[model samples]
Target: MKEQDTVDLFVIGGGVNGAGIARDAAGRGLSVILCEKDDLGEGTSSRSGKLVHGGLRYLEYYEFRLVREALIEREVLMNAAPHIIWPLRFVLPHSPDDRPAWLVRLGLFLYDHLGGRKKLPGTRTLDLQRAPEGAPILNKYSRAFEYSDCWVDDARLVVLNAIDAAARGATVLTRTPCISARRENGAWSVTTRNERTGETREFRAKVLVNAAGPWVNDVIQRVAGSTSSRNVRLVKGSHIVVPKFWEGANAYLVQNHDKRVIFINPYEGDKALIGTTDVAYEGEAGQVSADEAEIEYLMSAVNRYFKEKLRREDVLSAFSGVRPLFDDGQGNPSAVTRDYVFDIDENDGAPLLNVFGGKITTFRELAERGLGKLRTFFPEMGKDWTHSTPLPGGDMENADFESFQAKVKAEYPWMPRSLLQHYTRLYGTRLSRIVGEATSVDGLGRHFGGDLYEAEVRYLMDQEWATTAEDVLWRRTKHRLHLTEAQQAEFATWFSAEMREAA
Candidate 1:
């Protein structure tokens, strides 16, 4: 490998943790390279519950530190990416049979005071019989508790971090898998193969980071020929999307008889996202899906609290992701700690930082602290800076999304309200780059369906490293949900032809 090809850090995953670390390291003046076998966030990051929350249920396990850190990071992330991360209110109906009212109040109290909540509202008791939020709840639930959290466009979060990292001089390789990594001459030699072009490349790096999520162990044992005392427990969590049944922007949280909590959140304008069964999984992480029993369990839990019962036919789509949790010897998958752990293996002056078990809410802090573990090696690296800096497209004045929306409306009077809102919410201040000199809808090139325009697809291809239809349709954006099956097929054909012509 050429001397120029050598970097300060080599990251082996392109999920949120990997992307975040790459961004942080690059920003701190470290030459970094991030490689992923699939598209960014194709793993657990995109398939998350899509909330930047304090994990109210985690309090039951006495995870005070994890909950506190996540709570504090919520507003920090919202400030960093106002367009993609914003406040969401959750109404939890009082389930007297599952837990007593006082215990519920205690949990909510800690959730309110756990972190230094500045911008978000505190918790409040709700009269389900009188409040509009109670309209969908069954008559048995006459009271509820409402608390604040934030919703995130999880996939976009990963992409934006990668974009920011690349902007800061990090090399991002998607559709590329790290084939082998070995310590050599007090450094690391890493070889990666491009799955698309069958091209192989080599790099020399001073340090290696394995943030591979479900495949962290594979990267350790297979790719690096290294081992750690820590192991990741793969817990499968699934979510189902259906037509929106209730009347508000707020989400509903129900307590199951099994003592697990289920979130029924508003999703994608006209849909509801309900999910998450915590069944211990022993299969390939990529092959995990919502099994029949899991789907029925989720539906039954929602049916227990809601006046509108959901049937199997009502399910529009389902997705499952394996949580690469740090194994804590817990018998129940749900009881596994959501806290992140870094196993630093410093062998003869060469170091491998293996990250395990972190959620989207704590990715930034995880990156910051992960880099801190390597400070001794890179003594000349810059001080911490990502805390105050914004991610790509999030650099609006004061990180104020509503103000930016108003400005977009004023700037593009000819754009339809829905289209403008879509662009503004997804792209934020970066909307102009996608819009370019387009004066009308026709300038956006061919319309794929819904708000997916050719110009946006082109931007994603050129800027976001999107090489496949699913990269654009599912990971980078959720156009697949809106586009009909035939429409999706047509768009895929067009995308392939466009790529071929460009090539």
Candidate 2:
């Protein structure tokens, strides 16, 4: 973090779009700096429904292009990070009240053919009365459609992009908010203050990029003192974590009376991640949380299809994110486009690229296209190269995570099954960075309850720029859900001492 540093590009906001653009620019042989007021993926990027789907429902809105591009990127991303992104079979029970079976069939048909889906199985019809996947569902629904989509660790995807960017000679500043930016002699002068250290540094960037998700307008009007006619529609979508009640590995998508669809997916090992209600939000982005109605709305959607009822006591935790959708004058929040829009403001000669409205599934593509918009400024910059490139820790051959998992299991015969899976899933090929010279459970260093270990914590701090306990537990990993309150507090105490000692 040198003061008065100059680079080819300076990216503000370290969410998926920001990190992805940073990674793309750095890999294309450009010097880059990415700053975030919070940890990477601490915003909407981490709060998604955790799916890399083609937005199956968007088909009804005639969003064929968006769905097709997303569908194609589904496998592209799955191949890029097989450890975090894998195929998920969603059993969408056909409901007579909301959507007719024929219409649902047509949507699934388009979903199958639209993306040139390679690597994933096609759609199949299932008889809910006889199929094992429907055992948990009510008997009233006798038919369902099974289709393919990919599950993603949304938070890790953002971190991996940042990691890749840093590896490619980009400087990443976390907990550092860009306070000001202005055109200065054919270049942009930016100032940022690190929240943790209270240290301010200056940068001279040839081009400035605003990837601030919900705060896109804030950065443009407030921070940069620049204006853009383009506006972002802030829509808040929330999800809840509850115990996995279903018996199979399959997930369920049920239609709601409001014409919205809810997904009930198996999450973490013993829990389920269910969510996403599209509601126009006016509150601050950082203050967004799952309201009682949203939670009940989600639970009720599940109860409509599942025989195993989910009560209020069954909910473990809830989270929400504010999606900064490109305002298209669509009054219905659900009708808003999931596709991204780029607005490049040429402030004299320096350029500021503002990204708006994209989904987790198409982040890489969004990033690539975003860089393409600024090709003229840096004509010497390298050509596009992220489509086939692998993110950090996603270097398995052909992205075969199952084979990689088996290989690691054999190497560490003494490691417990759950711990091994946890390390592999979160770190992929980079698991060795943390498990270096570790042979047994004790080799992993102090156990802080559940599968959490000091070695992993140290690795995260050393590699992932994790500054706070919440960053490590909630963002870097989901240990917050597993550790009891006392155990979590104890781990926090140890973490504080460790930080103090390191300082």
Candidate 3:
């Protein structure tokens, strides 16, 4: 074991919240280190609904503050990473059986004007019989409402934040578990073990942050050997991916018989991403998986509105995430608050900040505010600046991805449109680093089916913290969706050999 290295901040968890805070804190000139027990975003962050919108249903629960903050963050994040985070219009097919049209209209009205909405179009009424967006809907849905939100490559978002943090001089250690921590003479002495190498390291930090999402309590009690009065209620949410059934670029939201709404959004250019059941989860967060009942429930919601019915065979893949919601004593899991709570324990002159709950939309704001709570401890720390700054690969001119994409099309005219899109959308300005001087498809080295070329794989391994083939296939990129089983097996074999050679 190496000698203990001291840092200003030590963050536990590699989810969006943890990565976002690490980026924000590092940019403000704080010496920081972030450790994740598993692969980056292998936890709850990647298994999200992937929308960067204020929870519309949250409005019904009178979460105005959370909704407004999320709404404002939508545009802020959109500008920060236009490639991964872009506007998505949702068509809500009016259901007379679920809620009154007048009430729906009022909610839409508030949603249109609630937060600082710039760069995104406002909500408008849709004539289901005439509008193009309603072409795939059932005849019973005569009217619909359209509103704007943003979609994110949720896993990539976490990776980008970590990348930015690393670029700004923060140490990011993935697949490293913080085994123990103790307050020692007004500082935290933390020990972490690397799962892959079986090497343990220690760190001394002035402040410790637990953003372990679903594992928050486990870290509080088991890892740190401390307790907090605040608690996290684990609410499981799931999403199913299937081939794209509807037309146009619009997504659909339909209310289920149980009053919960399900999102059927266009995904990965050729598929639909449908989700999510809010069941109270009590098991291990890593073991949380979508059951048959949840899948059937989601399918029923989609079938009620879409003209093209979905079957079990249509489900290409399904994922589940446990929301670490702040326990507000709500009976229903869905009724639990999505708002984040910060519990700061400045006991024995050492500080430990535990984050309870947050959404993808408000992660930046949550990071900014979390840092604000620690300002008194570090009076000389830099001010909040992530709102106006661009994330890594998000420095497109004026945050215009369309124009930048057009330029990429011209530059890589020899490449397939799909491949070009894959690069630009995933890497943005950093696409050149992946492509390099490759002028043709053969220049990209081996073709592993679909758009999984050797160049991109090497770039992911060299730059991104991608070790295992599954890390690249599932989390770092969605290549698994496009590749066949045999092709995936081949890639996995090649990735294993390459990693061994590198070692």
Task: Please provide, for model 2 over 1-503, each residue's C-alpha lDDT reduced to its tens digit, 9 standing for 90 to 100.
Answer: 55665799999999999999999999999999999999999988999999999999999899999999999999899989999999999999888888888899999999999999989999999998899998988999999999999999999999999999999999999999999998889899999999877988989999999999999999999988888989999999999999999887888888888989998899998999998899999999999999999999999999988888999999999999999999999999999988889999996898989998888888899998888888898888999899999888899998999999999999999989998899999999999999999878888899999999999999999999998898899999999999999999999999988888887
Give the alpha carbon lDDT tens digit for every residue of 270-368 in model 1. Answer: 999998889898999888888899889999999999998999999999999999999999998889999989999999678999999999999999999
Write candidate 3's Cα lDDT for 261-366 as tens digits.
Answer: 9999999999999999999998999999999999999999999888889999999999999999999999999899999999999999889999999988899999
- TM-score of every candidate: 0.99, 0.99, 0.99
lDDT minimum window of 10 residues, candidate 3: 1-10
Instruction: Output the lDDT of residue 389, model 1.
Output: 91
Q: Which 10 residues in a row give candidate 1 its minimum summed lDDT?
A: 1-10
RMSD of each: 1.0, 1.0, 0.9
Clashing pairs in 1: none
What's the true lDDT of residue 447 in model 1?
Answer: 93
Stretches of candidate 3 exceeding 4 Å from the true structure: none
Ranking of models by lDDT: 1, 3, 2
